[model samples]
Target: MKVSVLVITYNHSRFIAQAIESVLMQKVNFEYEIVVGEDCSTDDTRKILIDYQQKYADKIRLLLPEKNLGMHRNFVNTLQACCGEYVAILEGDDYWIAEDKLQKQVDFLDKNLEFTICFHNVIIFHEDNQYQPYLFLHNQPPVSYIEDLLIRNFISTPSVMYRAGLVDNIPNWFYEQGMGDWIFHILNAQYGKIGYIDKVMSAYRIHAEGVWSSKNRDWQLNKTIKMLDTVKSNLDGQYEEIIDRAIQFYSQHLLKLNSIHQGTTSKFTTNLPKHLELKDINFIVFPDWNQEEEHLYQNLYCLVRLLLTHPENNRIALFIDTTKISEEDANLCISSILSNLISEEQLEKNKNINVFLVGKLDQIQWRTLTSFLKARIVLDSENSDALLTSGTEIIPAYTVNQLIEFGLIFIGSAKPYKLNIGCGNVRFDGWINIDIEQNYKTVDLVCDARQKLPFDDNSCELIYNEHFLEHLTLKEGLFFLKECYRILKPEGILRIAMPSLEYVVQKYMSDDWRNQEWLKYPEYQFIKTRAEMLNISMRWWGHQWLYDTEELYRRLTESGYINIQEFAWGKSNTPELRNRETRVDSILICESQVLK
Candidate 1:
């Protein structure tokens, strides 16, 4: 199949070199034609494309738009101009990192007749082109079903290769609204499967200039809301689920845009997402300075109010240099009324709303030196009280252990010798709450469960912990479990929610490992380090045990814990919790009893 590489640009003279170089570098079995639509760039961006066309006439075709067609209109027009069976797009600001990005995509499309579109994971680089692991780390999996695509767009324009025929039926109204790309894919998926390559094959540059830049986030999000409505309206009975989910996502994104637009001062008004998670950054009341040029100080004052004291804005993370802040400054932020993000009214109004202050990133040295030293940013935030109280109670509530529905009743312990080691923050509403830390107000016992079971044999109905067991020393933890056997009813069960190591590696460590970069430099070979195959095995999250759901079954069964069934869930925090004390949120239910 003849693949048409549609390259569009407004003014990307500096980055075009890398973009063109990538196309020329492809070593594929089939030939691909490169057609570039230069949108009459006032700068030398057009001149660069002209030179590339002249040099590679056989491989490259350059189309000069008489005047600027703008971003959305430019790409849709390029489709009509380019003549090829297959279509792939590469915007000027972003470029392919992989030489085989096109070839691999084409090959996948060629072999998989059912699949019409293909995309791979992209690595997001800084404007200076620094290798940022955080972007890749957060990037979701490449291969997704139609259901996954509906939640949000995974394929960036630069990373996608689609069938040319699919676009012929698409109208200009989709593009005119500025969110043509999303509609393009949703339409294609209806015809067949969409393939994804699980590698970082493209470089996505994020800065002030691009259309989807953080500054233009409002335009993109607002446009996205419009597109979602269009998709929701067109949903046939079969596509209803995706469309419904899209509506929910549309509302969430709209609310996020609202939060971002109102200068981060306002509490989230739109009641959507059941559990809204904001990791760590505090900048509310940031005005749309780009839109309001005439009202500069008004925007500036709004930004200052947002920075200093903005009511209703809940900062999930505040990335500040703690060295520049004092106890007085801290008190202003903590006690400020405007900093009143999740009020009592807001909590009853919505569900599980969280705000935080994350203070670490590349080279933007946090004003405070000690900001990087905290063990767990999520647990250390002003809203930690809220996380513990997320589904249980409303705010002004500080204790995690004081919930009425802490009703995760375990029927029995696996073995009389089996010990319940580390119980994160999940306390039994009726049982003893034990931990070595004096800090947690609900801790019933201050001794480490890894060393011994403080209780006698055959006591606990069940040995249960949410996402907490993986953090203990394996040798000590194993011994502790053996002791739990000494205190369990014969018909007992060990209900544990340990970390799925595979899930963690894929989520944080695999292709990009930037989990811990605040205190030290990001060490490369990221996946292996996070897996802790070498010394990572020694102490991970201050833990000594690693298990997927499979190993948990083997370890407990070997220790004489009968009816030992293991359940796994995902947890995302620096402390990396797995069992009790931590709130485990998953829909999967596991019920078992110790062999009577």
Candidate 2:
């Protein structure tokens, strides 16, 4: 045989068929066979492999082990079975995108006898995420030597094609190494230089079940350290410095394992805008002001002194000139102070701290101001006189400071709260899990999401729901959004994950379903015809309404939200909301703010 594709699989029932079909689809002039080593998978992987072998009886061979042989043993046994001029490695979860992938590599290897291995670029796509696909070793040079292979395993497994007879009996250490692909590449590199094709011909799938993909950085680092140690012993300390440097870098990475902020003490320094800066203290009153304007500056200075004394206290001084300044100007100034002076984190923390010093304000003014700003009022007192001494009356204003302190009865303390609505089985840390079904003990509140939430108005800091919005009808969805807006505090975030109408429509209409590369996967074959695909798009999983970006944006805007931003699947500004389990290509994420 000219080429033998060595495919190693274990419990990869969902992906094995695609791997086999990719080989079957290859446009090779010479004969090639696929050698799949089924390591006695507990899943339907073995059955799937057997079916593929029957379908491609002449071209496919299976090493069906009675018991689990483990990854290292299975890989070694699989490699030994390939009796071809050249062999390519493709893990069950990975697939070749290019039909001429093998032909191109074989031609290159046939001409370049000095090269021990031939590899090309591979697209590394996350199985559970819609993140933009990235090329593996995108910047690596076209030609790589043994020294390059030693430093990094730049060649992805699916992209590699090496001389078949180059490797006979796999080393004992290879069985013990955490990353078998690294050792395999290193072994081939020892014979001659490694060749690289610049074009992307394959895709490497990263999912929860992946060997190195699922492992934490600490585990991966430890594995790397062990592999490097083994390499050092095998090579007689030839590449000591490079290996040592890598070990050192990874060892330091262990210190950063607990990346979550435990006790972050970020100091806040408020920088006033250039326009707000006192150029002679006359800017506040603007034009050539008389007595009232002059006195206003004196009161402002006193207020500034008081604020300086208690900088930590949440105090807001609103100097409103009903006659002099327009409402737009007043809004701009307030917006500037809040936006420039306060950070989002700080704002969330101090949302309930009501300490406002209002000047020249009526009931209408107070209503307008309070509607926008949720802060306490600072009343005139003996301390206020102490600063002003010869004060000519601090602008005729009414202070509801005492009333707010005594009358306003809050249902709960202003402790920031997060809510997960329609939370079927999933639970978020430090969040109230609400669901219609109370099957799980994690569910804190049980209620239908279509109705009003049990949460108090302007109480929740964040509300997130994945794959829940589409279940509601247009009217119900609008009501749900309104409810979310009502419960969320000013500047509270509402993150929603829903099925993408655009993605589904495109998938149904496109001829991508016809291609072998696309048809090889089961994810695309759920619906047979275009009508079924379209019907499934709307009716699947008891969906009432499906929305694209534009529709979703309109609904959110109508429900009184601002700062709306769309995120790719499994992506959000909020780290806690970035859950891969709730992600897919058909899933679209959106987040907006209940701007006060």
Question: Best by TM-score, which number?
Answer: 2
Q: List model 1 lDDT by residue over 161-187, tens digit each.
A: 888787465654666566667778887
RMSD of 1: 18.9
Provide TM-scores for the models: 0.48, 0.49
| Candidate 1 structure, TM-score to reference | 0.48
Candidate RMSDs in order: 18.9, 18.8
Global local distance difference test of model 2: 0.67
Candidate whose lDDT is highest: 2
Clashing pairs in 2: 354-375, 354-376, 355-376, 356-376
Q: Candidate 2's residue-wise lDDT over 325-412, tens digit each? A: 4556545544444443346324453442222223444332322222222222233322332212212122112233322222112212
The lowest-lDDT stretch of 10 consecutive residues in candidate 1 is 366-375
